[model samples]
Target chain A: MTGESLHLESVAGLVRGLAERRFSSEAVTRHFLDRIARLDARLNSIVTVTAETALDQAREADGRIARGQPRPLEGVPLLHKDIFCTQGVRTACGSRMLDNFVSPYDATVVSRLRAAGAVMLGKANMDEFAMGSSNETSFYGPVRNPWDTERVPGGSSGGSAAAVAARLTPAATGTDTGGSIRQPAALCGITGLKPTYGRVSRWGMIAFASSLDQAGPMAVSAEDCAHLLRAMAGFDERDSTSMNRPVPDYVAALEAPVDGLRVGLPREWFGEGLDAGVAEVVESAVAVLRELGAEVREVSLPHVGLSVPAYYVVAPAEASSNLARYDGVRFGYRCKDPRDLHDLYVRSRSEGFGAEVKRRILIGTYALSAGYYDAYYRKAQQIRRLIREDFLRAFETVDVLAGPTSPTPAFRIGERTRDPVSMYLSDVNTIAANLAGLPALSMPAGFTAGLPVGLQLVGRDFDEGRLLGVAHRFQQATDWHRRVPPGFE
Target chain B: MSLSDEQVSAIAELARLSVPRDALRGLAQELSAILDFVAQMNAVDTSGVEPMAHPQDVPQRLRPDEVTETIDRARYQAVAPAVSHGLYLVPRVIE
Candidate 1:
């Protein structure tokens, strides 16, 4: 392969090419930064560009190659969701409150990615404090879909999705809490995966609902996601919730055959709200799986419809607690006036957060408050268990489950922003996976009325290997994942 | 089913959010719509059900007692709004 071939290559392919000396890491890094320069202006997908530091790291990677050191992602260029902390870099979680906050230490995931030799291409924008489903809540500005600038790239990982769809970076890291990763990938028409909750370390990623928050990857293909997940995952003693199981060779699983795999289509996922066009494309993707020698059956996760409400209560109650640290005392934005200690606390917070974040804080406070805890927050937790049990019962019969990643494809910018509930509904189709703590992957299935749709593949906890194999076989049978957004070049 | 202005203000205080009074009505309206949507949860009869705080059945993991990590306050507090003699400074609470 030529050095130019490294430009749009997947993580696995780029690593292969660079390790073979077909292209220097410097040339490849320069190519991607140049692509970002060319394609990112109109998309507004990147929040900050780390070109200077990325090149410095690429130079170090080249020296490692000279030393004959070996690692899987030695020369790959990657972007990060702004939510993850990077020492010395402004790690804004898309909130005005943290706009000036620079982290003191590298997040565990960032350190691992660096150890694997992936160059930092800077941070992608997300919803402020990961509170909103749409990137509209971001302090920077909403990210435009590279496909049609008029439409939103699904968020709160919208920037990461847009960059990959436009090939700004080969792959990037994203955090999912209530569908942030998969929804944005579906809207932008790319591939993304959210591993089982404990599979990836959360030591450095900013907290949302700690129970639902997880970090994974967005890329052009399932093969690339597998490689990125391999580097992003492992047991970290620092994160108390991190699972201490043995990490598998996720990329190797992609090459496995899909023979005899049992896939279940939950009856609940195809109900009243699914867009007709999206349903049609999803059915066609199911047909392709049957053709690939996989067994397909109808299954029911009875509590599926309850995921959104459960997520709303659980996530906010946690957020209401987590965001208390940013009271303008430690770092970032602060108020100019302080009549007393109480005034300082109130004014600093009041001035720092925007409408959407404050709204969630209120909602969370209500749910967990003295009178309503039993009625609202407590009840939501009970339903959450039933939701998990529904998956457990289904998984007993099927190896994997499939659903449409969203009710519809990406909508126009400002289409659902005015109605906050509608924006929250965008995640309705994807949140069950998070609530169940299951591994889920979304890949481009087809298009509807010119917009792309994603077919989500979800499996039992720690079943990322099975999910990747299923996605890889489908990719081999179709070319949808290779389809880029219009005008990306 | 909808949150009121007073409710919004009270909730804000509990959550440590400092919403300006002018923003309360709008906040109440927006949060009302979302709460109304989530109110669907109340319709289901979960009387005898147990509330689940986690997805897994596993117990919480414990770490061995050791001095594994520490932060340098002098360096960390370099960015504080106010710090003095290795302590963070704040507006006086008591007269």
Candidate 2:
């Protein structure tokens, strides 16, 4: 097969082709590396391109294949969101704080994928410390939406989503604290999954919100996500929150019929603030599921409206604590000519962090401070319980909840950056899933005004198999996920 | 619900971050708006609701207290900004 055809192949197809030796792993890796070097300048999606390392790994993978010692994901080229710590590579997390810091150890997800024989292309760009909704906050630069270059790809997984949509790599790893994976996937016209909290290990992935952060897969289709997630998920002793449960055979689960599947449409998501164009696309997508013999019904998640407010408190509070480790003395950016230890801490943080990260740290500090702990932090946590209860209640009646992943399609860069509150609203439809600790994914539903819209499927805890299965069936019935961005093709 | 510049400065100090005096006014306004936005949580009656710290309600798992990792002191200190004789060097706290 030619390089052009290789770029168009899905993760599953690439794995099959590699196994069949139709194309050598080195050829596939070179095709993507060439694409990244030629095309990534326009998108600004990649932070670093590991061409030499990638080629070396590919050559090794070809040797493995020749010796008949291939692993499950042998020779698959993938990009990791810069948030995951890749030893010896710059894991910037899109922040200047760690711009010069090279990780000494690999994140559990990285090690697992490597053990399964996945090759790393490089780290993808992201919002600085995963704080922003749009990718504009990256210190490196904003990632352009492949569908419309002037627009965002959604973030903090914007780089990963754009790379996958542009076919620079077949799949990439993405972490979602609040819609980081799913929203970008929606805006960029790809598939991204945010597994239930604890379903995937968080051992070395940089933390934005300890309780909400989850690492998952972003790819061209749900089946591709399944293939990637199988290697990326499972319990790790290093992560206290990692659930000790057997990972279901996600690829096998994709073959399950969507017939008799119960999908709930949250009434709150479809009501006000939803763009009319996106609503039409999501509804039509649901109708396709209904046509495939799935039952649809309206469900109430009344507390979801408060999720954005609660998330701001909870996420920032945890971030304030998690980010405290970046005190300039160890592992990250430090200031020069400090008069005292106090000066070192203050100036290093002030200079190292960007505006949004500072804003969150201050908010969290105030919330957890002496006078306001109960009013802000505790109250948000209490409201968090209400949100989780809402999902649990909905799940009692439906196998999964389906809705628009984002309230609108990819907005123009610099559109909402000035208004922090407006940027926070970009995740309004998706934040509740993270708060509820449920499995959620965004798959290409259809397009609106030439831009892709995502239909989000949220499932019960550890129910990623069902979410992927449902989305796989939807892709089979609709041509949405297969539609590539024009220039990339 | 708006925060004063003094309050913003105080919060920054608490967080161990330095905010230039000129930036405090704008920072205060932005933070106040976020605080105002999040204050909507007060509308709900959460009187008896338990605060959920983690999604998985599982208790923290503990393993046998043993040395599971080799001491890779050199590797761990490779990224430190300043070091002297294998110890991370920071500005002295006291004379």
Docking class of 1: medium
All models, DockQ values?
0.73, 0.88
Interface RMSD values for all candidates: 1.5, 0.9
- lDDT string for model 2 (A37-106, tens) is 9999999999999999999999999999999999989999999999999999999999999999899999
Query: Chain B alone, TM-score of each model?
Result: 0.78, 0.92
What are the fnat scores of the candidates, in the order listed? 0.75, 0.94
Candidate 1: tens digits of C-alpha lDDT, residues A204-259: 89987888899998999999998988998999988888898999999888878777
Cα deviation of A78 in candidate 2 (Å)?
0.2
What does the lDDT read for residue B63 in candidate 1? 87
In terms of lDDT, model 1 sits at: 0.86
lDDT of 1 at A196: 93
Q: Which stretches of candidate 2 lie over 4 Å from their true place?
A: none
Best by lDDT: 2
lDDT of 2 at A368: 94
